[model samples]
Target chain A: MAQVINKRIILKNYVNGFPKESDMLLNASATIRLNLPEASNAVLVKNLYLSCDPYMQFRMRESKAGSFTPGSPIQGFGVAKVLDSRHSNFKKGDFVWGLTGWEEYSVINTVGFLFKIEHTDVPLSYYTGILGMQGITAYAGFNVICAPKKGEYVFVSAAAGAVGQLVGQFAKLSGCYVVGSAGSKEKVDMLKNKCGFDEAFNYKEEQDLDAALKRYFPNGIDIFFDNVGGKMLEAVLLNMRFSGRITACGMISQYNLEQEEGVRNLYQIIVKGVQIQGLIANNYLHMFPKYMEMIIPLIKQGKICYMEDIAEGLESAPAALVGLFSGRNVGKQVVAVARE
Target chain B: MAQVINKRIILKNYVNGFPKESDMLLNASATIRLNLPEASNAVLVKNLYLSCDPYMQFRMRESKAGSFTPGSPIQGFGVAKVLDSRHSNFKKGDFVWGLTGWEEYSVINTVGFLFKIEHTDVPLSYYTGILGMQGITAYAGFNVICAPKKGEYVFVSAAAGAVGQLVGQFAKLSGCYVVGSAGSKEKVDMLKNKCGFDEAFNYKEEQDLDAALKRYFPNGIDIFFDNVGGKMLEAVLLNMRFSGRITACGMISQYNLEQEEGVRNLYQIIVKGVQIQGLIANNYLHMFPKYMEMIIPLIKQGKICYMEDIAEGLESAPAALVGLFSGRNVGKQVVAVARE
Candidate 1:
């Protein structure tokens, strides 16, 4: 048996509110055995890219069911290559993406969740975003939940981020008039130019979100792909058209708050006969094969585009993850743990 | 042609917030011609039962659409008898139910919305409730929006009121464990004993609505027929089960408030993967024929029961309508303006 150095990011404590970089610790001194245990079904893999998602913020809190324990390596979605495998489904040379540890190498006992990479012609880092959970989230939220019709008005918040950018593009492909809102001017430009949205705005600059929504969606919003869920959601509720659909994918704005902002205009949902539904990507995993079948060709044809804000090493993971809340990332934020 | 003195309840001014008896005037000096005009497709009717519904509160305010004009007669759903007719669908001596004025006699020009009563075996006042808009509201909200399954947990707020009482019975008929919340002890008792709810609670007595909900529904609410939308709605959001459905019928609690209460726990809708939908009975009018077919049998067989708090004469119409805000009426409130 041989020993190898493993760099990891560990949780310092159960997070109370907005997570700071100091709440996580970076350790390069930990060591792991290169050899696997006999008769075990685990696979040992070297992580290449780790995804920073808003839902991961919930895992840092003190929840009885799914929260990350203090002093443990924070777990998230990542792209990895198997170094060794005792599982029949995976091999030493197989590249995969799934739930993995925030370290250089992880012994993954969770065999069912791991998916072996089939298409490698595109960027391998995309396995963390476009080919993984984020892709399926955009697919299910827009296509399945919203069920948008052509020429409908579609609005997306956090529209420059991973799932939102794709949702805007999908809306356009469906012949919908799509508008998106981002935090910065650069991100807003990226939304309109790169993501193919009909219009985009810097929500941070708008003093009155209701007036902003009215200006953009003069006809009223038919489908709202909501990522942020505070005052923005409240404003969107007022401007929604009759029989509108709202896909409540993530409430990134409320996740870090001590007390979430109260939404006042929910009464409007009744007057308009709207349907607001919540969705989780994990529940729609069965649709991944269908999603890849639809999305892979779009990516190959340049009809779909994706962007990643990559940090250099495992040491940059804490800052990269924390940046998501403040809208520092231009697109999907990922940490490059190692190069193949 | 003879002239008749028709007493009416007229709006004194455009109401801003909670309505008072003084906001409406009892006009007994107004007179109408007993004869219909030649070549006019209108029916002159004597109002028998004027339904006092919660939605009428919105009409008292100054709105661009649907609000009552100052110095005009208050409009509402009512059961009436045709004293004279120039319309082919209705003739003299025909009993009908539709939108009519809150007066002793009204010349109805809109015949399309009016339905001629076919079953006179039941009380004519039943046309104001179980056989009319309120019946269809409960049918559409519970059966259409909620789409509940057997053995599921169902919750109704304002549970002894017009639509709420019917919704509880419908949920029970669907083999669900139904719980209802009312403002008073008598109403709570009526929900459990008369409406056949599995359990009932006086919301005024329960300081912690969430805890009360937890006590009744240890599993979690599968369907929530929301009538009181302020704090009760906020509490129900926390106790909903995964993929639960909520029918946003009426927000009686919020209607009279100058500034409606803000709902804080809406984030729970996302965590539970619930669907909250708004409904208007008018949109589902096509389903009316089918609704009556289903409900008439239930009413005939004594499987369905209804209660009405009837006020004597047109003089009490203002107080009866205003009483709905304070939960003063025990059941479906109606004003007996005249005998058919």
Candidate 2:
């Protein structure tokens, strides 16, 4: 078997509050076999793109289950091409996307989360974002959980991030009036001008979130796609209309806090007859085929626009992942490791 | 026209913190005609049994919408006899349960909330609790919202209260292992010994709510019918099982507070894929006939036990309404005004 240098990003320690690039170390001299072992059932792949998601922050924390182990390569959703395979479902040279390591090559044993990429007409890097985990998350969380109706008023928090940007677009496609909140003025401009949102605001600049929400959604929000939880969620609660739906997709704001901030306006939920639901993408993976059927045409027709912030190499993975916390990346953050 | 003195419980002023008996006054001098005016289209109901509900507290506050006007009789759900009717739906001598005033005689203008009682086999006072507003609330919150499955672990806050007790019994009927939390040992005893709950705990006795929940529900709670929100809700969020359902029925704990307590463990909601929905009885009134179809049979077969704490006469209404905040009234609090 041919051996190759597999550059990897390994966890140095379990992160406490606010993940730092120092917590992860890039190992450039690690070597791996290009082919799978004869008796092994795992598939060997060359990683093409690694996705940086806010949910990965949870895995970096000290946890008994689902936490990243120290001295090991961190795992995340990635686009890859199979170098060798002993599994019947996957073959050599097949492009796929699923849970893979932040390394040049990964030997994947569990095939449950993995999916073969069918359409090559679009960008392969999209498999790490719009056509992958984040895509399914936005589709299910917005369409299914929200059950939004035409002419409804929609509000999305962290609206420049991977899932939030898509949810805002989905809301517009559903014939709804949509407003979004991001961290920076550039992100707000991108949301309004590029993504076709009715209005967008920089949440960091707003001293009173409640007043900002009221100004954007004067009639009150009918569906709230919450990417940043904590204070934003509380503000949204106060501004929600009767029978409003809230999708609790991610709490990026509170993920780094030692003690998560308390939400005080929950009483508004009862007053407005609101529904708050937490969504996990894995649960909605069955809808991927349906999602592709809708999204592919929208992309081809130029009806849908997806923005990606691409990091240059595997060495940039740590900064790309850490930048997510401080709102450094404008859209879906993907690290380009190898083109083919 | 025959004139009659209508004894009424009038709000003297808007309550700020905890409501006191002095906040309301018994207006015994008020008089009204026993018959409806020639041109007026309304139902004149003789209030028989007045219900003391926690939700009425919201109406006592100074609000632009749905707040009770000062110097007017406080309104609640009650079983009434129609003395005169100008409305086509209701007629004289008809028994009804709906939103009526806390008074001896009420000329109800809006017949939208009113419902004509079909069966007379059960006690009329039952209409104030199990067979009326609270009954429909518990049924819709548990059966429809929670969607309970057999062998699921169920928990109810304010478990000894009117709606809470019924929800526990409904959980038992669904073959779920139910646990209840009340304020006193007496209520806890009633929950376990009388209501068929698997376990019952006096929350006041336990300093740490998370520890208490862990001790009772080691496997984690699958369905949580929350009546008293605030701290208990925060604790329940930590102990919820994956895909757990929570019905945000009534937040009696925070209703009187100047600032409602903030819930800190909402991240657990996303971690567990939990769903929290608010329940207002008016929203689910469309399901009342369906609820009656289920509950009436259960009541007839003695499969359901509804406990009521009767406060004699209309004079006791003020104290009875105030007692709810203190958990002073066990089970359903009903004021027996006129039996005939």
Cα lDDT, model 2, residue B225: 92
Per-prediction interface RMSD in Å: 0.9, 0.7
Docking class of 2: high
Candidate 1 colliding pairs: none
Off by over 4 Å in 1: none
Query: In every candidate, what fraction of the native interface contacts is reproduced?
Result: 0.80, 0.79
The sequence of per-residue lDDT tens digits that candidate 1 reaches over residues A1-340 is 7798998899999997778999999888899997688889899999999999888888999988889989989999999999889999999989999999999999999778899999988778898898999899999999999998999999999999999999999999999999999999999989878888999999889999999999999999999999989899999999999999999988888876778778888889899999999887888999988999998999899889798999989999999999998999999999998877
Off by over 4 Å in 2: none
lDDT of 2 by residue, A13-63 (tens): 998877799999999888998987789999999999999988788799988
Please write out the lDDT profile of model 1 over residues B1-340, one tens digit for every residue. Answer: 8798999999999987778999999988999998798889999999999999988888998888999988989999999999999989999999999999999999999888899999888889988998999999999999988888999999999989999999999998999999999989899889888889999999999889999999999898999999889888888988999999999998888876766678888888889889999997888988988998998888889998798999999999999988998999998999998887
Worst 10 residues of 2 chain B by lDDT: B251-260
Model 2 iRMS: 0.7
What Cα-based lDDT does every candidate model obtain?
0.91, 0.92
TM-score of 2: 0.98
